[model samples]
Target: MSNSEPQRQATVADSQAITVQTEHGLYIDPQALSAHLPALSYRDNELYIEDVSVSGLAKQYDTPCYVYSKQAILDVYQAYSDSFASLEHQICYAVKANSNLAVLGILAQAGAGFDIVSRGELMRVLAAGGQAGRVVYSGVGKTYSDIEFALQQGIGCFNVESISELSLINEVADQLDTPAPISLRVNPDVDAKTHPYISTGLKDNKFGIAHEQALDVYAQAAAMSHIEIVGIDCHIGSQLTEVAPFVAALDKVIELVQALADQGITLKHVDLGGGLGVRYIDESPVSIADFADALLPKLTELGLKVFFEPGRSMVANAGVLLTRVDVLKPTEHKNFAIVDAAMNDLIRPALYQAEMAVIPQQLPNGGMQADDTKTWDIVGAICETGDFLAKDRVLALAEGDILAITGAGAYGFTMSSNYNSRPRASEVMVAQSQQQLIRKRETIEDLYRDEMRWQDQ
Candidate 1:
């Protein structure tokens, strides 16, 4: 007989058995990692979250499940609150962060306002029982419906992008017979030091009005009696970790605000759009307190109310995506592990090449074996060749195991699509000792809920 003992098979019953020696070699407290999931412990070569094991969640809820921790959400939100406690600020939780109604409702209950870009988002916030009066609308292309909705809701304000948009909003408000609160989304032209796809503060991006022209736009917006210039806004980028860019933008914005004040348009609020990054893998984001300490005093000194639209930073670590391994294979040059969750479910890896911490239901009895622990390209069953989650990941995993993709709470389900006619997954919110199914799993009919296939074609 071999010296090594037979390992416990990975299954729903074995969820807590895998002690996180290291989730992808990143040092994390096993307690903190499993604190949100109480019954989880490492033993017999597997992992478990409380009595309901990782594989167990897969069996009960099926694969490609989205699991959220209420405590984690509260903790992260509280972190932001604590960070900016010393300042006159309000965190308008970017509804785009995990846009799940339940998720939004959770944050809303914690007293978070919203920053919405689309009418659909506005509807979501409302449907989730979010307060509309506290919501602020931002984005360059605000459709008529979006404007009308924001006006009807009487949100805090709209971060307008252009002079034409300002005029259009004024016209809409006039026709609607309602005064629309507006703010100029200034493209501050500062290098946010972030990914290009998410960078919005640059001069060339299709996000905000040029900083040089912001004064004119503000002047024009101020003249419209139907449009009240309540604030000046700028979003440099998303997933940013540095404070220098924000300080730089604030310096420019303060100058403009001073200029506008000289022209008799005193800004009531200064909306510094969100770009704070969170820890996904070893990426070290600035502490919430540090960010606030850097930003709040600057705005407080200016004597203006401040608004922050944070998306990823608030909910990125609040939850994870659970998928079951379908198959595993090895070739001459590499290894492969196919999971049930597809790119259509979480697009960050494919869209932005973002890195995440991937953990399994249980690791093998032996420590990471080089040959067995090959660099696997984690893929999904989606039809597209681009339907991959991770490339060259070294994990000692086997078939039928569950893989927990970290940092999925924010953009995963929010960006999901039915790309190959695949049904969306269910989402569960874990609060206290109880787990609730906030969203039900999709059935075959859900896949065709919007498809009107008339046989006449």
Candidate 2:
């Protein structure tokens, strides 16, 4: 933590030199709270998560590991559920964002439904004890196989992105001799004020059906014997912090729904695709109650069953990717603390220009630093030159200190890969002081198991 201190080796020797706390004299800080990330905690200069110790977790699991506090996942799910408990909305967990069967199983155990984008994702939900009757299949290009799979599972409905997709679903369900329930994913053209790549509800984006065509599509689907018009849906975008766009999109969707009813095509559900944002940097997240307060009244007035496909908001901060410093280099221009993690492990900062709160396990002042004097660049151990995590970070970090990148529970490990042949990291979940390995660290043989040497035919 002390920049002036000579760079030390990243080992337990660095950890041993620290003085131990005395039980008689040491009193827990009454004001101690986790980093305010979902249900995470950063107390007493240490992370006690779900009753499990953070540093101890890294010791058992290894560096560049993802440690999820099990309780945080529950708390986040309940946050949305409680927000709309008085209402008749279904919180359908988006499986594509974080489809670890373990994570989905946990949510399913807590009575959560799913919003799947692929047949494989729908199968994952089913394998995790999620009911097909509660899952909603959503994607733009649903293949014949994908449609057949969803029809077989009897998911809640398909969010048809285009008219062609609706026809395809009708054919697939007709061939399979089943009635496919569907919802038109209408594009309201609302700007969700998010990254360009992840935004969905806009007309320009290749996601949902255009707003003008939604009513006609629904009417036609109602006439088809194989396809039943069940609902309407839209996902505005990801990491959205504003309530105005969603409120606007809601109005647009309701208007479309009313237009469909004028033609005698009444829908039973309205899947308001989820893109409610979370606090990642300086921005604050609108409370679930505020979102419900903003949109539920409109939904109730319209008299429709509501559905949500929240992915990021429910899991983003429920976990943290814990990495250890691999080396350090102090140049005249900047200090680079290279950790064992890489962009392949967590790409949000590199891909989205995302900013995560970088907290060193211990600083010179015992995790308290308000100095405007020192700055360091936290980077990863990867081959690519662009493999940096945090730029101009304000922490007075040294070579060996462990760092916890907050708000990584959702799109973090799910986006990681074995780039540069580096072994993918493992993941652990801690609940009530018990830490269990949810995912294993990849081995070289495991990576090459699917690969084979063959003579050219």
- Candidates in order have lDDT scores of 0.78, 0.78
- After superposition, which runs of candidate 2 have C-alpha atoms over 4 Å from their true positions? 1-35, 363-373
Worst 10 residues of 1 by lDDT: 1-10
For candidate 2, write residues 167-221 as lDDT tens digits. 8989998899988888888899999988898888777899988888777677788
lDDT of 2 at 149: 79
TM-scores for every predicted model: 0.89, 0.90
Model 2, 157: alpha-carbon shift in Å?
Answer: 0.6
